[model samples]
Target chain A: MSGSDASATTLGEASERETLKRIFPRLPESRSTIVGPGDDAAVLAAPDGRYVVTTDMMVHGPDFRWAWSAPYDLGWKAAATNLSDVAAMGAVPTALVVAIAAPASTPVSDLEELADGLRDGCAALAPGCGVVGGDLSVSDTFTIAVTAFGDLEGRAPVLRSGARVGDVVAVSGMLGAAATGLRLLFSEAVDAAGEPDRARFERVLAAHPETVTAQLRPRPPIADGPLAAQAGATAMLDLSDGLALDARRVAEASGVGIDLDPGLLGDDVEIALTGGEDHGLFAAFPAGAGLPGGFRAIGVVVPGAGVLVGGRPFDERGGWDPYIGWDGHGG
Target chain B: MSGSDASATTLGEASERETLKRIFPRLPESRSTIVGPGDDAAVLAAPDGRYVVTTDMMVHGPDFRWAWSAPYDLGWKAAATNLSDVAAMGAVPTALVVAIAAPASTPVSDLEELADGLRDGCAALAPGCGVVGGDLSVSDTFTIAVTAFGDLEGRAPVLRSGARVGDVVAVSGMLGAAATGLRLLFSEAVDAAGEPDRARFERVLAAHPETVTAQLRPRPPIADGPLAAQAGATAMLDLSDGLALDARRVAEASGVGIDLDPGLLGDDVEIALTGGEDHGLFAAFPAGAGLPGGFRAIGVVVPGAGVLVGGRPFDERGGWDPYIGWDGHGG
Candidate 1:
């Protein structure tokens, strides 16, 4: 069938031969790819002699819901999630491979929409880094797993083990927006009725439109990571967990103490310290190093143990623990 | 708890955090990795460079069955499946990250065993490689997804489009063993209540124990891929979708025809033509180039179209098609 004329409904039922004929030509070819999709595996070139890799999985229920997320959003989220990992490493994302599992009954239109979303996300976050290859399988529920790769270009990999005493702690991008967005989505403010809670969801829309969008679709600070690394940042990481817990991690990894400046947090101290899912970058700079663009100094590393928020010992009373759920007030 | 005193029952959950701690001591000091695992997103070292990457997924029901496969086997298979792709590109396997989804009730011991399996698989298949990172989530069924990275060592990648009409088709490792082994495992003879079917299963098992193991745990010829590239193989690929289909892929990509000599099958035409899950290296060599070690001449490139078996056209009827099921045949 012609590319534009091919219907999504027929993509799965058509034999593997036909699928190959239709899909193979649409993919782009690059000199860095020795082998592209269609083989058992695609072969890629790692010019830097070292490669950085990461993976993430999005399940239909736990990670996303179809009623709330469009197929394109699902695709975009899948790519964005893994890209955040690669970006968090201060690496430049070069390519991605995705494995998608959905029910046989899933409309082909949905799949195409998902692909479109993936293309959009990659284009926005990582130019020239497209979906190089992927596998499609039939499953009872929809699942999307994406893997991303980056090149260090012969520079030493900025590992989590490099923080030292006297380092300056800093962050880039907004924190807690995604977390608050999620809270708004799940709260009683959104009713679970017509169109899968659109009415109640509207309340969330009315309350914090930007935060809700952030929660629904996180846009990782892809460039800020590398920028921080280049700016003499001594230690760096992505803020996925709450600030306090993640700060503790940096302290432990760097074998130093972390003291956060509560005065700097303004009104969102609780959300800033306890929030999760903000794909922002946090780095520890050498003493006296100026912060880079999009970054703000937030704390300092000292010769002690654990993390202290606003000079007070931080506890697990706030933030998120997978088993304990959210610990912030009203959460 | 002491390493020796660690209880197997608590191995999965209790040790996960501890293992992260243990790895801290072995990590290299890098400024790019500002934050590590304890945080939501890891800070990584991204030097100023481009990146190359790929991803794959393994579902419980479609890829492996726990009834006959152990947790360790599943882990090894998952890692191997992704690593093969990295290797196929003439790249040295570097780091890997995994995302797993499984039932909450899954035994802790099973999860630990799976982790051990991943470690063993990476060590054996791609030395110096580490699991590096991962995510764990609860799901109704088991799913494993791995993303792998590789270093190209400055060599130009061997693309599928470089094959010439006179190229020789060569392969490394055995074919059809996995497919045949799977057949024996799923047949009525193996799980049937009757004596006759049981006898048939026993006969097949006795005759092809290696085949059964091959299906259960495929060992991809990872090293051969790079070797073939270094040896100047015009085009190369990994054999996963059966010989005929995969060979056709090479032909289509190179814009040439391939002719297989059935007589060269050496008494296992069924396995050579219709086998799946071999994960072997298939390369097209210059007409006069010597076959690399571990590779055998199986076919030749011709000046026509598609793949021909014994001078005759081959169809998908004899091979594995996930949509059509196994159909109780050679595939």
Candidate 2:
């Protein structure tokens, strides 16, 4: 790239229209878009007479660090996380409207890469799903807020309150990998003084690609969400805040209890039980109903009020909570 | 409220769930909400088989100042701005998904008041439209990102590119009050050092309630949007970035020129022509079609490429461009 190109130019030096002109070409238009970006709002087809919507925010420091996450990774993770929520509702994501607020000194190229990542993430995870519209603003802190829309295709939404006692508890997608990746970044990817070092971070990522990738750019089982719902999932939710805490939420919402089998979760049972940000689908199905192809039975619903591990109560809330969990560390 | 209540507690001192518990009661449920908050995603009805979607971001610095606006005003303006975009598309807003990222030190009661503002903004401007879902996170910059969904009720969306050479230009709602209010804020509602002063802002606001309220908590004519479309408006857009710049946008999009009659605008024609953030509906109607009730004719469309005032080409682009206009001052 030349000195005047996007890589060298900061957003502060560019007009909002000029920046948008650069981004519009990289973004993919959704199949359902009647009128895409550039207008006041994008018009999208809601073929089933109803749509599922979800919004999520990822802010610097509490959500991710510039030392660890690339602009592309941030965009991909934003798309993946919101798409997972739509899937948890048994809906196919149709469109996304993303609003990014970054420091004016941010490179215009960074936003271009983010747009590419959003396009690629949608194309890979949910074909035909694309970014239909978005907004940009200057802020002191970088924040990405995404609202995803999903098509239910005439199916009734599978809610978290539907799980019944005697239903088999199951999950799709890796559970412990993302949390393990975060631990690796914090422990092995930092310098001697506990700051993130690019060299050390790259070394750790190279050594544990799967676990680290799970943290940086997760590929949730988006398709399996609708499949589980189609197969009569009684209740479902995205396992964003660790299996233990999220399962307890389902139990509490459903007026039932869940009993998990540690042996079913991989070799690192503790990590699988308490780790979060996997964005996997956790669901309940009738005992006789066959579980979906990607899902494996990990537990059973029981008559009670909370979660259980081998018939004993597991009450420790081991999941991410921004206010309580973030240590005020940027890197 | 007691100190132990939301008034004194900061977000960092409360869990995400605890904060949500306090906010949920203050929010109103949309009439079309199939599933509201607490679910992984919200389900909303799209009775017209299509939806108009838009997203807008307001960061603390370029958008508002703490000295001038309360949390309630921020929330109300956020809703009003996004709702106006939906209305400009000739659609009735059905739902809103708001994402707020604020500093951890922000008091919880500020957020509760913000939620009340969102509720009331919806109730007063567009009845039956409510906050269907939202996300919250911790950030150094207070940012509000809102995604609005609107139902067309089967009418074709009025696009900015639909204007013809002979159309009459019209506007609904106050023109220069918001920008005039902002000018007053910048010039008089600040201390000698050019910093916003709370007491000075309140004094200025009390002296000019209509103008200051136009800036702090805009009440855009949301109902006029659908009415214009029903009455045969050719092109429409929300007058967000001043009459001159936004009209130029419509003119350029439509391959025509708009000529405004300064006599029709109120006194202070420069402010009326160049002021922004009123979020009013600006539209073009056939000369033969009777203008909508709230709308008043202000100009005429002519064959050309930009905006004009009294047959003279108005070349200066006067509008709020965060990147180019903000002086990097938060307050």
Q: Please give the distance, in angstroms, between residue A103's alpha carbon in candidate 1 and its true position after superposition.
A: 2.2
Clashing residue pairs, backbone N/CA/C < 3 A, model 2: none
Reference-based TM-score, model 1: 0.84
lDDT tens digits, residues A255-295, model 1?
88899898776578889888887777778888898888688
- Complex DockQ per candidate: 0.26, 0.88
Q: TM-scores of the models, in the given order?
A: 0.84, 0.98
Candidate number with greatest DockQ: 2
Which stretches of candidate 2 lie above 4 Å from their native place? A1-3, B1-3
Candidate 1 interface RMSD (Å): 6.0
Off-target runs (Cα >4 Å) in candidate 1 are A1-48, A153-156, A164-166, A189-199, A317-331, B1-53, B152-154, B189-207, B323-331
Give one digit per residue, the lDDT tens place, for model 2 in B1-331.
3555657888888888989899989986798899999999999999988999999999998889999999999989999999999999999998999999888888999999999999999998999898989999998889999999999999999999999999999999999999999999999999999899899998999899999999999999999999999999999999999999999999989999999999998998888988989799999999989999599999999998899999999988788788985667657
